[model samples]
Target: MKPQLLFSLLLASSLPAADAPVQIGSRRELFADSFLIESFSGTHLQLQTPRDEGVAFKFDQPWEGLFSGYATLVTLGDGRLRAYYRGKAVANKDGSEEELTCVAESADGRTWTKPELGIYEVIGTRKNNVVLMKAHTATHNFSPFRDQRPGVPEGERFKAFGGTMEGGGLTAWKSPDGLRWEKLAPEPVITKAMVPYKYMFDSQNVPFWSAAEGKYVAYYRVFEGGIRRIVRSESSDFRTWSAPVLMEYRHPSMQAPIEHLYTNQTHPYFRAPHLYVSIAARFMPGRRVLTDEQAAAIKVNPNYFKDTSDAIFMTTRPVEGTAHSGVYDRTFLEGFIRGGIGAQNWVSRTNYPALNVVPTGPHEMSVFVNQDYAQPTAHMRRYSLRTDGFASLHCSYAGGHAITKPVVFAGRELSLNFSTSAAGGVKVGFEDVDGKPVPGFGLEDCVMQIGNELDRKVAWKSGTDVSKLAGKPLRLRISMKDADVFSFQFMP
Candidate 1:
């Protein structure tokens, strides 16, 4: 269906209260405002926005030659950000040589300065003055780490570990400041643990240190049976590592012959410890629009020959001591999934729930629900909630899920409101962390009081005593009778 027509149809079905403001609670409408269904063919990388305004860092410098491989960002001790990137360029006068493992630094994340530290001694290179790493290395795709020890006498010293087929397995390097470097060990750190002969090997080191888990995680991408998969290992001293555990994130779109699956830094936004991965895919080309089916079929395969334009972003937030994991951020895959292009049934079969920490209210927050209706036309629906007596129906459709961005309501008491299609007869109520209804609240029998016909805005207030939930963390669950909901938001 046409975008405008589909939107109009959905809006027309909304609760028609001329003066009431529309409330958003479902995942569909929560993201409806600024959501852009990205395809695989886009040039932007994942997690590039939200964290740092939507500006993509330019790794390619005309003076530095083209083909600058993937980059890993790390924060230094003094709070400076350092980027370790793979440098691929012609090396010799005969055009028979290549350079690798080039390092650069930036005080702020935007502008980069490549210094001539003389790590590598080249015979005849006088164009842009490219001084490569002395130690012969090819691909440099790892996060940099600072080796700070009590007796070590720190003065801007760091180390980086990554994989290289040129040396058989993974390798490690040391740097006094991050500019100059030397190989720590002669051999690879962890190599060919349980794999057959020597199928494929690549590693992407994560930068964040997990104090809760007490172990640092390193995510690696491996190719087996022509399928791409992600595996993780833990390290305490960055020297020895645990055996690789297969990650739940596996899709045909993320496979790569040269680079491995890499993730962003860990932060509080994850609720728990999380990792963001940069995936490579070939989504639809240009800004041209397409039907939902046409958009869904768009495939994103890894193209090694092409520049860094095909990379996409995905996330993995571990369920914290659970075997099953969840994909926290997947807006990037929406277009491909909806378009019915590559891996049509992949996400559904693979999509698992993460350990989500629901926001409690001495304050208020939003909850979003996602419903997929096959009949009529494929679309999604939404709902909104607030702490005050404020509530309303947001939007509805056939084939999308709901997600809520965590919001904080200011007051001690909060109100929740909801609405649903009369045909669906929505059930509205709250549940505790264990998926059970709150005490004294009858969820099964509580019929949501319908407010209007066109917009379907219904509201109910539950005064949650936040005296106990003040500083502690908790989750809120909202249920509807049979109607699919997008989300509910909590306001002060």
Candidate 2:
């Protein structure tokens, strides 16, 4: 059945007398644009789920035990992947001597092995995977990122931010490789005095060079109305950051129930670097899932089993001149990764996500999570998702259609990452900003797009080339049946 089409879709049903086209600049944009999706008739935008790959690495070292936090993973140039997290056996106030930053490596993200760096001796052994220790309390949550900014010093190729305001705000560190570290500044780079908030910089404060904005971006935890929330700050250099502003959620999210976000695993998506994705842990304080008996069986910390939490996803396309204006789309308010099977999975802060999501294979990306925290079974588990598969414009067998706001572009071909059932298919049509279908590019001209593909070019009887439409404001009308369009990009 042909899906119904809407004309000049607006933020409302009644269109402005003569609405101006949404002037999408000549950069590659993604379907992640929630604002573009003005309306969907019988269609819905769906969030994709990550498949669990069990334990990627375990915190079984004698020195390491329950209470591991701030797991960070990075893919290296040497064809290896590195995992970093604090190794602690028992609960200690944030920066106790018990906390040691540990390292684990993997050739493939699946099987991980900890290499004995033997750099710092903790737990009476110089033969463990301890990377940073006794370096003040900063190692308690040392969050690191590969500094890919242009002209970054060889020794400073790796950068990190750690420590709380009580431990002296956040201190900067540099590493030639990710293993060894040195302080960028003797004093903390960002302090409580810099921001108006009193209790900021408490969790895994993450900072990375955003190639899109050409600045250093950091997402950290801050208290608001006594509830945990996320804030954003920026810097041209890693040493100094802009004042932290509470991140605001857009339309649907602003309307949804709020929860405490523990650690925001916010990072630039590898494919769409401009779109920052956050797989943040939604902490449900005092929301107990395990009874005392169940908690005792798992040997969870007495204080830990009282609450439970899981991961949620959000995205933002940061613009340069926004101070507390960046919008986060919590399109999916439900848990991205739910606690499965066991009561142990629901214990306090067990499913706190790591800092970054790394690509493990050509078609797949993996996110590491700190699971079973403060329990004897505490370890890191991996969740896998197809490339560009975080969210999709989805429809069921009943089928539906969506019309995008007018956008400008510069490309010869339109490519989509999508999947469908045998009977499901997708068809796309182009229209001028005025809501008039382009000649030879109407829905009737489209050849039904079927099958699953990472990059499939949309075509019509007029052929796929649309270079002539470059820079002209246009809209896309997509109709689908039992299919999901994960993402789309126009390529020159």
Clashes of each: 56, 1
For candidate 2, give the lDDT.
0.82
Candidate 2 weakest ten by summed lDDT? 1-10
Model 2 sits at a Cα RMSD from the real structure of: 6.2
TM-score of each: 0.49, 0.93
Best-matching candidate per TM-score? 2
Name the regions of candidate 2 deviating beyond 4 angstroms. 1-33, 320-325
Output the worst ten-in-a-row residue range by lDDT, candidate 1. 348-357
Best by lDDT: 2
Put down candidate 1 lDDT per residue, 1-492, tens digits, no spaces.
Answer: 432234335445553343332222221122211121122111122221111122223334332333343444445666555555544443332111353555555564344566565445544443332333433442444445565433433432576666545445666666677665556677777666533324445434443334435555555555544444455566776567666654443333453232222222222222222323233332222323333453244321122111111223344543333322322244344221122223321221111111111122332321111111111111111111222211122333231222222221233333333334664444334344344554444355344543322223323344344333332222333333333333233332
Q: Measured by TM-score, how close is model 1 to the native structure?
A: 0.49
Candidate no. 2 TM-score: 0.93
CA deviation > 4 Å runs, candidate 1: 1-63, 91-97, 116-134, 138-143, 146-157, 202-208, 250-309, 322-332, 335-467, 470-492
